[model samples]
Target: MALPTLISAAQLHEILEQNDLVILDSRFYLTDLQKGRQQYELGHIPGALFVDLHHQLAGDETEQTGRHPLPEPSELADTLMNLGIDSQTQVVVYDDMGGAMAARAWWMLVQQGIEVFVLDGGFPTWQRAGYAIEAGCNQATVAEQRLTISYPWLVSEDDVVANLETERFQLLDARAADRFQGENETMDPVAGHIPGAVNRPFMQNLNEHGLMKAPSLLLEEWTSLLQDIEKPIVYYCGSGVTACHNVLAMNYAGLEAKHVYVGSWSQWAKRILRKIDEANA
Candidate 1:
């Protein structure tokens, strides 16, 4: 059987030279956009290409759309191709921040039905294992491939708005507890979350060391969380970025996470702020 999409450091190191494998370094910081690239330039896993969250994985932000609006599937497919990913390629992505940022890349690819592996415990684990590291920019040979998008797994802002009245899906917030409670309002100017969304901070999926918890433990936690809720689960975060971490966690725990509010709290907050401004105007 094939390895799951969350591969460990040793597993990745063992298959580094496989012809069909492609490794990506996706380290990023929410406050400092350029920091990730600076770290990658210093050192990265051998043969790993760097991918920026905003520039590559996401599209330009508008006043209405969230901070990290997703790129079109075709655009992402082009990005993968440009990075030397072919149809037969096995892709693995990692970041220093555990799987938080890397999961964004995984979601974008997985939405298009492409299976992507996130480096379990991410770059820190690799470093701890004393794997080979290379510095500076590594050139990626362009690949001639047009990827097919056979699966779409997102709910639009309109859908979310409609759900408020219908209560068709369960809203799960992936922000920190304080942010969810309208207290630690740091990232976004608007405080609090969507009216009915429940809090499940993305970090809950990880242990004290910032590594993802075991699958069985995750299974227990997720099962208990979703125990009485019969509605389909929908995940969201400040900018629809870290929310993917929850999606990855749920899937890692063998739960089917088929929906994401791509625009997430960013878009929702933007909309609400616009309304408040209009009223004040």
Candidate 2:
């Protein structure tokens, strides 16, 4: 059977030579946004195009939207074409901070009904494994803008509010333990996590090197946190970025869930009427 939701370094090396494969470098830092591109210029997977995590993954900020909102589907479709991505292209996305940022790119592509895979360990793993790395910018022929509206699998704040008491789902918070516990709310004005939500930091899916652990290992870790798989799993993080990593990890474990809370903590905390940290506490 084929590897699930993951692409190996060797496999990636082979695909790098293929015309249908599109490699995207998604390395980014919230504090230092330009660092990702700088690293890409230093060295990257051959033919890999740099996808700015802040610009490409998120929508424009508005009074109603969160810090990293999902962009308009048509706009994103245009971005995919510019990046040389198509329905049949085998996309491989990776980043430095575990797979959080990279998974955001992965999820965005999937929202367009394009099945793209995450690099299991990201660029470092590929380099450590002695895989070939090319320096400077790499470019490919931008694919024709051939995008079709598929399913909108993203969940909004309204959906979360309505399903608060429903037994049909579980809201999984991928934020850090401190943020979840309300001890540390440095990022947002409102401290603590959503009501009735459980904390499951996205980094738990990977090791120190930012690579995903074995599928069996991830299965055990996630199953322990969530006792039942029948219940629908909805994930959220600071701004819907890292949460996608958890979703992608779960998909790798053969437990693909539905409707991730894309707005995540950023949007969730903006509500004053709704209970914030107390519900889940």
TM-score of predicted structure 1: 0.95
Strongest candidate by lDDT: 1
lDDT of 2 by residue, 62-169 (tens): 656678987777777778888888888888888766677888888778766676888878887888889888889977688875686443778887888898767567
CA lDDT of each candidate?
0.86, 0.80
Off by over 4 Å in 2: 1-4, 165-167, 228-230, 273-281
Compose the digit string of candidate 1's lDDT tens values, residues 181-261.
Answer: 999787777899998898899999999877899989999999998898999999899888788899899888888885789
Model 1 stretches astray by more than 4 angstroms = 1-3, 149-151
- Cα displacement (Å) at residue 93, model 1: 0.4
Clash counts for all predictions: 0, 2
Q: Provide the clash count, candidate 2.
A: 2
Give TM-scores for every candidate, taking all chains together and pairing residue i with residue i: 0.95, 0.91
